[model samples]
Target: MPTPNKPDFQPVLIVAGPTASGKSALALDMANTFDGVVINADSMQVYKELRVLSARPDDGELARAPHRLYGVLSGAEACSAGKWREMAMAEIAECHAKGKLPIITGGTGMYLNALTAGIAPIPDVPMRIRETVTAELAEMGHVAFFDKLKRDDPETAAKLDGNNTQRMIRAAEVFAHTGRGLASWHNEPVLTPPENMFFKKLCYMPPRDILYDRCNRRFDLMIAQGALDEVRDLIALNLPPTAPVMKAVGVRELSSYLSGTTDLETARDLSQRETRRYAKRQLTWFRHQMTDKEIIDTQYSESLADKLRHDINQFLLTTPK
Candidate 1:
């Protein structure tokens, strides 16, 4: 396979879609064809403890192509979008220096948005403020805390799901520390992307029924591949509930089963349902948030690659270098 002609600025290929939509497979194929480096954009896949649950590229897949930013962090550490963007930017630059295309693949919309669209440079809230807000949330409960957030930062509160404790706490902390609503900071001018770099975006939007079925089957495969044991070991670490890894799709459901609070079948059913719902949410996000991408309406396969070959080649070979 021929490498892309050296361009003046980096050209990144982004393969984005809902979970179980085969983004990794497509990215691996593109890497082999274009002498590219496959870089992870998924939040969960970054955690070292979530191999099966995150559907991270298996050993065979990893060996077939160069990959970056996968399984680089411990589950105990929270990977905010800013943190991931910093890491991904380093990987992307390294790929460019090595004369390899950077193919970023994942389902995490926030991480993708941070990379491609830029994000607000909101100042970090003090740890003291974060702890205070968390304590208040614990004391007042989600309902009361959310009501307080509505009064204090209605713009942010209105956009959030009241049940999302982490976001609620974050909103409250931002307001407490800065005396400004989180939404206001978001509306501020954000860190801009590099002026010369270009992105070629591809998004998969498979039929809902087919996508849902795939989600179900994929969860079953996760179980067969030791997702339960993975969760067991993760739980043994006793990471805080607020840790992002603890909120992965199957983690809670499987944890319940591991603790003997639910049967394996019941846990599996709930996990599958949650996975489907998560996929639906992802589809909605990409549909509305990333309207500029080239949308492929089917799940990835060899035929899909064949179909996209000419267009991708045009992008790599014909674009300015």
Candidate 2:
């Protein structure tokens, strides 16, 4: 097969959708066609510990194309969007220099948004503050964490999701360090958009029923594929419960069950429910963060890849400068 003409301008192929919507397959197909490299955009995919659960590209897929940043982070490290953007910028520039397309795909909107449009310069929270807040969150849970934040800075609490512990801690950490809520800093100004003409955005959404089905089945599959043991190993490390990976849907549920705090069925149910909620958040993010992209429906997904191929070709043929 002949290669497509090298795009004269930077053209990033951003393939994003809810989980299990064939985003990876579409991205791989496009990479093969355009001699592209697939960069890890999913937050969980960054950790080397979650190979199957995070759905990192399989052996055959990685053999076919070079994938950057997948399974590279230690599970213990807190990987912020700022860190991801730094790594991805280097990878993207390398791909551009080599005249290869950089195909970016993931469900993590914060990471995607950070790269496509530039992010505000947020300082890293001090380790002492992180440990302190993480410990407090463990003892008090998110409710108390929210109460503390509301007392410390009511404005940040008003804007934040009470249950989002990860972000909540980050916000509190920022305040503890700079004495200013991140919300105020965010209103400062724009630096650049995530993409620089190089990105051709392709957004997709599976219907609610389909997405829920995927989330449920994937939960079962995770159990079948040793997700329990993975959590077992994680817990054995004696890391704090507040560690990000320790809170991943299946991990938390299974860890609870293993610790005899809950039964297996209840754990599985809660995992499925939380995963569905995560999917909903992803859908909302895509709908709001990006405007220029085309949205593809995967309700009738029997022809998903074919439809995606057609869309890419069509977009390539007609999209203007």
Candidate 3:
């Protein structure tokens, strides 16, 4: 393809990896080093109610550098990848205007892909259609709703798990309102980023054993940091079970404990296991979907940051080819 018009093109740096891979720390280091603004790309981190479970940057870390788009949404509102992309693009422009680099960081592959590769032009389903589909799914439950989705949009259903309540409802709403399967809409050309924006991607891929250990230890630390209280507050919101925040990795397991369905120890173990599984999936997605990025196969540390300085400096100074 012909090179995109180079004049005024802005460069963005991306720090992506699985949970507990230290991508956040790396982003903070980069922000302090490069006079950059760190923009949130993690879906959960955007919700105001999920700070503890989402492992969102704490006040001290936030004080180290400018951060944007973190904890900006209510858990009651769902944030789609396209929605996040819009918000992220605006933040990037703001950073560039202020003569600061934009450092995007997160483990949400879908959100990152939306920013880098763009997203399909899937129209928003009407509120009426969405409400109706959501109610129907709640009444029928996931298994039945998934079966209905299979009949209505088999291509989409085949790719989704029955337990992925939010996506299933989304698929149903799209099919009901548009008279076309969600999969078909995906086949349409995606709405990509402007040619004037370029991304320098970096992914962390810590060894599986170390990554899983970190996932387990992090949950323990979260509990110590009053994650149970966070879950309690979230439950008080009475958000629908399918609400995106409600489905965060620790929410369900911890909620089970609070509801007397499981003991604390069991909940803790299960939550840690789920966290590990989530990390594994994230690693797989980054490995496959972000193949053209620089890879760091070890955990982040001060030495790693020192080693990365030269490469990041080059990315900041050079124009995209």
**Residue 245 deviation, candidate 3, in Å?**
0.5
lDDT of 3 at 189: 94
Q: lDDT by residue for model 1 over 205-245, one digit each (tens)? A: 78999999999999999999999999999999987776788
Candidate 2: tens digits of C-alpha lDDT, residues 78-168: 6778788888888988887797878899989888888887788776664567888778888988888889898887777898889897789
Q: With candidate 3 superimposed using the best TM-score fit, by how many Å does residue 29's alpha carbon deviate from the native?
A: 0.2
Task: Give me the displacement of residue 45 in model 1, in angstroms.
Answer: 0.5
Give the Å error, residue 178, model 2: 5.4
* Per-prediction tally of clashes: 0, 10, 0
lDDT of each: 0.88, 0.79, 0.88
lDDT of 3 at 156: 93
* Cand. 1 Cα-lDDT: 0.88
Winner on lDDT (1 vs 2): 1
TM-score computed on alpha carbons, candidate 2 = 0.81
lDDT, residue 164, candidate 2: 90
Tell me the lDDT of model 1 at 284: 96
- The stretch of ten residues in a row with the least summed lDDT in candidate 2 is 1-10
Judge candidate 3 at residue 254 and give its lDDT: 95
